[model samples]
Every structure is written in structure tokens, then in C-alpha cells.
Target: MPVSKRWTVEVLIGEDHGNTSAVARLDTNDGTHLVGAGQARLNPADDDIPAIGDELAAARALSDLGHRLLLTAAADVAAVAEQPVHLTW
Candidate 1:
């Protein structure tokens, strides 16, 4: 049986105004490219701008990871259904 795998690439960018954004790309062997891109605006409540930026970046990264995992699981299921099975005794 042939094995299929998923690859994910993520990028996090921070703006000068304490805003952070993330872009995630998920690639699978079945020629599927899933994208999960988002932006996070930090609230300057009591935290400093730098601290807010860090928190926003972390939150964005988690969001990207969650999206990528969902896409990968979906791709795996689809690939399994489409792949041919061969058995040898």
C-alpha cells in the first residue's frame, strides 16, 4: 500500500501597531492545497503594545495549527477512499 502524508507551512507577521496575522498552507499527496489565513488585532487594554503583539501572534499560530489539522484529516480520509488497495499473502 502506498502511504500518504500532509505538509503544512505557516507564517506569522506582526505589524507596528501591535497587530499580528498568520498564513497557513496545507499540502497533501492528493494534489490538494488547503489555505487558512487570518489576522488578529490585539486589544491594548492593560497590556503593553509589545506584550499584546506577542499574545496575538501566539493566538494566530494556534488558529493556523487548528485549521491545518482539520484540513489534513479531511485530506487523509479522501485519499484513503480514493486509493486502491492491494493485498498479498
Candidate 2:
């Protein structure tokens, strides 16, 4: 079996002198339907605020997508395993 499903990821960041927020969205390959969105925020109090915000946002988005993929793969594997198979000698 082949998986015809594909996804795309996009990230947007907003920042002030000390505050930052980032939103990551995942859509279908066509970029029409949204599959998931992840958000992250950073305070100026943190070290390397901009970089930290970006890293957190990217990590959240990637983690979200990775979790989805893992679940889907597990379900497919389980389904295939449940199917009856016959062998002839």
C-alpha cells in the first residue's frame, strides 16, 4: 500500500522588543486545508529570545506533525496485521 497523503508546514513569527510569539500551521499538499497548528511564546527575560522563540515554535510544529504521522502509521500497521493471510506449501 502507498500513502497518497502529503502535508506542508508554514510558520509565522511576531515579535516586539522583548516579547515574541510564533504560530506554525500545517496544511495539505495543496495548501488549502489545514491539518494542525502550534503556537509558542517567549519573554524578553529569556536568553536569546528571538532564537528561542523560533526554535520553540519549530519544535512544537514538528512534534505535532510527527505525532500525527506516528499515530497514522501505527494504525495502518495494526490494520495490516489484523488482515488474514494464507500460505500454501
Which pairs, if any, clash in model 1? Answer: none
Off by over 4 Å in 1: 1-6, 49-58, 61-89
Tens digits of lDDT, candidate 1, 1-89: 77577565655565666566666665657676656566667566655566556556656666766666666666667678896433322
State the lDDT of candidate 2 residue by residue for 13-79, as single tens digits. 6666645555556677654433333456654456665777667666766676666655655666768
CA lDDT of every candidate: 0.62, 0.61
lDDT of candidate model 1 versus the reference:
0.62
- Prediction 2 TM-score vs. true: 0.50
Segments in model 2 whose C-alpha atoms lie over 4 Å from true places = 1-36, 83-89
Report lDDT (Cα) of residue 70, candidate 2: 57
Best by TM-score: 2
